[model samples]
Target: MSAGAAAIRVVVVDDHPTFRIGMSALLAATPGLEVVGQAASRAEAVGVVLGADPDVVIMDLDLGDGSGVDATRELLARRPEVAVLVVTMLDDEHAVYDAIRAGARGYVLKEAQPQEVERSIRSVAGGGLVLGAGVARRAMEGLAARADARPFPQLTDREREVLALLAQGLDNAAIARSLFVTTKTVRNYVYAIFTKLEVKDRAALVVLAREAGFGGDER
Candidate 1:
């Protein structure tokens, strides 16, 4: 951020009013950043970004009315040049990976210091991928846990679990019972797995899973 360089234009998108205000104020006071707009939901996020044309968007994972992941995906689809940085309370691997899959350029926990947030925004705005220290470690651990031996590595850990159960000839209800999730949730995971693996039918999916060394365990 040079003295004469343009300040990075930014939009703050969060469901929490206090958090949004605080973040906007911090960015407003920062030397090389400018707070251009604010939004509280997914629709507002897209509207504000479209209207403001900010260089960066600070997004939350949960919006009261809709998901920030969906918002990020929509925003990037319409404005591919705009950089998105997810600043959310969720630190789970699924949430983090989902945000990244939705095209977030950076992911940082809400607990990150103001300085860290500012640095991440600037880094993403400049075309760099940024992940908070804890987030980086968690992401690495998730990857290491699946390390090469796991089939369909693109699928999340939970998705892999569902696939393994499905390969074992368990129906959605059985999977739901085994995983302690609702049947609908298991169905959704199965759909996502099918789409990701490009398998058209259940039998084919099971065969593919078996060939890849999954579903061998009794569980």
Candidate 2:
């Protein structure tokens, strides 16, 4: 940004009041950003962001009342000129893809350093696409996988779920607990997934899953 340039107006959209307050404070402290509004849900996000007409929007994926992805789509649909920066807790490739599809110009995980967040906002405001650290690799893998065509289009939904958890580095025991299934059941699902995907082991399954952008909300 040029010196003495007008501050980039911003809107913060998250369900949590504390997060909204903290983010507002952070942007307020920044030299070239101005927080113009905050929203707690999808409806509020649309109304607030449109009303504020911000240069950039910091969006959360889970907005309590609805998905941030949906809000991003709506916000851009109304005002395509506004840049959206998704600041969400979700770090998976599928989440990144969703945000990108919804017209977000940037994605930053909530766990990132404050500087990273600020930089992402600036980058998106300046007409750049910014992915959180380590996310670009997964996104690239996912794009490659999709370009290659789905190897196993017939894998059952349950098997896909199991594979997604595997890609997240979850052990069989953890997957079983998360899915509310027995370890033996999870093992059976894993074997089925491997057979369907033509993979030999957990490592191979993870590779395939990452390439295919398998990480999403299983619940």
TM-score: which candidate is best? 1
Candidate No. with top lDDT: 1
Task: After the best TM-score superposition of candidate 2, give how far the Cα of residue 138 lies from its true spot, in angstroms.
Answer: 2.8
Over 1-219, each residue of candidate 1 has an lDDT whose tens digit, in order, gives 766999999999999999999999989999989999999999989899999999999999889889999999999999999999999988878888899899999999999999899999989998999999989998888888869655677999889889889889999999999999999998899999999999999999999999987896724
TM-score of each: 0.68, 0.65
Summing lDDT over every window of 10 consecutive residues in candidate 1, give the lowest-scoring window: 144-153
Query: Which pairs clash in the backbone of model 2?
Result: none
The ten-residue window of minimal lDDT in model 2 covers 147-156
* Model 1 steric clash pairs: none
Candidate 2 C-alpha RMSD relative to the actual structure: 14.4
lDDT per residue as tens, model 2, 1-219: 688899999999999999889999999999999999999999999999878999999999998999999999998999999999999878889999889998999998888899999999889998999998767777888888785575456777788788879888999999999999999999899888877778787777888788878766543
Query: What's the CA error at residue 209 for candidate 1, in Å?
Result: 14
What candidate 2 gets wrong by more than 4 Å, as runs, is 141-219
